[model samples]
Target: MASPIKVCVTGAAGQIGYSLVYMIGSGAVFGADTPVSLHLLDIPPMMPVLNGVCMEIADCALPCVREVVATDDPSVAFKDIDAAFLVGAMPRKEGMERKDLLAANVKIFKVQGQALDQHAKKSVRVLVVGNPANTNALICSQYAPSIPKENFSAMTRLDQNRAQAQIAARLSVPVSDVKNCIIWGNHSGTQFPDVRHATVAGKSVYDAVNDEAWIRGDFITLVQKRGGAVIAARKLSSAMSAAKAACDHMASWWQGTPEGSYVSMGVFSDGSYGTASGVMFSFPVTIKDGKWSIVQGLPIDDFSKGKLEVTGKELCEERDDALAVCSAAQ
Candidate 1:
């Protein structure tokens, strides 16, 4: 067997992390042939819960999991890691302003990013899953100057999956039949779930659904607000689906997306599609040999262009707020 790759997940005791750890243990993110040394991190107060999670993983006897490390220290958890799921962050409280929440998370990610820079493998792949993810990712990458900006990405695969599922349901086709449903800009409600270039079982989505009005209206809103809808129904944020999407994200990153296909990831923008540079923005990206490139040359209609502008503006504002917070700390 090949040497076990070191994988770390922060917030390993939380709902999403609970589900995510099991998936990783089962070789969902990495291939079944590859063994993984799992490093699970949570806050000191949550160590008991994290320990219990480790115990459960031991009980499962998953062949892919070679060893497990549970710790409260970011340095310990990040040491020599090959990849990480940065799932922990300060959530927005009921009365807290957006800038306040950003300030709180900026502290969290800044510390973790330093840990990654000091201890993790130079080629470590990092995925930031916490809310305000695009800006949080930008913060994390900024603090880890040793790591390539391309190695850092925020999760927008969840949004893309939601878009594909909605399209499939609308067409009454299997979800697998949906392809290339792109998520443009931030992961927030301003994201544009563009189906303009999507195909449904070898036919154009527009040709298959025959409802441009619904596609431009309800479909976009539903995918954008699906997280809130889930929270309303379950009285909890999305965990199971979020875990699955994270797995899909890492797996695609590890093993390249199939030829002629792509997925959405919030990566450092290189001014693609007129987005601001240095901000983490979601775009349709294809992975190959463990590297991702933005899909180029997709024609953007006026409506899609306007939607991109909205989300891009939101991200820029968030990035500025986060930078102000970081500057204040220094």
Candidate 2:
């Protein structure tokens, strides 16, 4: 058998990391067919917590995991990594200044990007899962100039999955029956869940429901606000579901996307679908080999265009913030 692929995850002691380590170690994300070795990295203070999680991995005795190592150093953790999931960021706490938080996370990501460029396997794929993931990913991609732009992505698959679930619930149809659901723009409140591209049971979603008011009012709000809803209901941030989306995002990107179907993923924009260049945003994408490419030839109605621009504008703002902050620092 060839050597196991090395999977590195930052922030491996936190809630999402707690959920993700086991899944990745067991080959749940990549599949049992591919053996994996996990490199779990966390901050210094979280080393004890990571040790506890590592003990659990030992007890589980997952054969797919050739080895599991926990560390505090990004350089050591990312060494020879084949795939990396960057889930670490300075989250918003009470009274934290936005600039300060962005600066802190940028510092972390800059070092990570450098380490990945120096030590990871050639063509290593990166997924940023933390808050403000788009800009953080941009920082990493910029710092790691050697890595291909498409190899670094942010997590918008969460927004996409939520969009699909809400659409299925509205029409009282199975989620698998909802086809070609699209989410455009940022992963925040402004993200647009475009049902214009959706078909339920081979019928257009608008034709099935025929309620313009519902689509504009409740449906859009539900998908846009779903992350906050999950936090409110669970009394904690959405972790497992977020991890699941991360899994799906990479799985679809690494494996081939099915024919005639595409998924939403956040990748560096090259002006595709009229998205602004240098801004990272979610687009309807088809993956082949190991890269995600925007699906071509989809008609964008006026409503969808407005939504896309709204979210796209926010993404450009994030890019501006990064450039401004990094420029000042330089």
- Models 1 onward score TM values of 0.97, 0.94
CA displacement after TM-score superposition, residue 130 of candidate 2 (Å): 0.8
RMSD of each: 1.2, 1.8
Error of 2 at 309 (Å): 1.6
For model 2, the superposed segments whose C-alpha errors exceed 4 Å read 92-101
Q: Write the per-residue lDDT of candidate 1 for residues 99-181, one digit (tens) a residue.
A: 67677888789888889999999899999998788899999999999999999999999999999999888878999999999
In the range 76-117, model 2's lDDT, one tens digit per residue, is 899988899999876655344445656778777878888988
Q: lDDT of model 1 at residue 11?
A: 91
Error of 2 at 177 (Å): 1.9
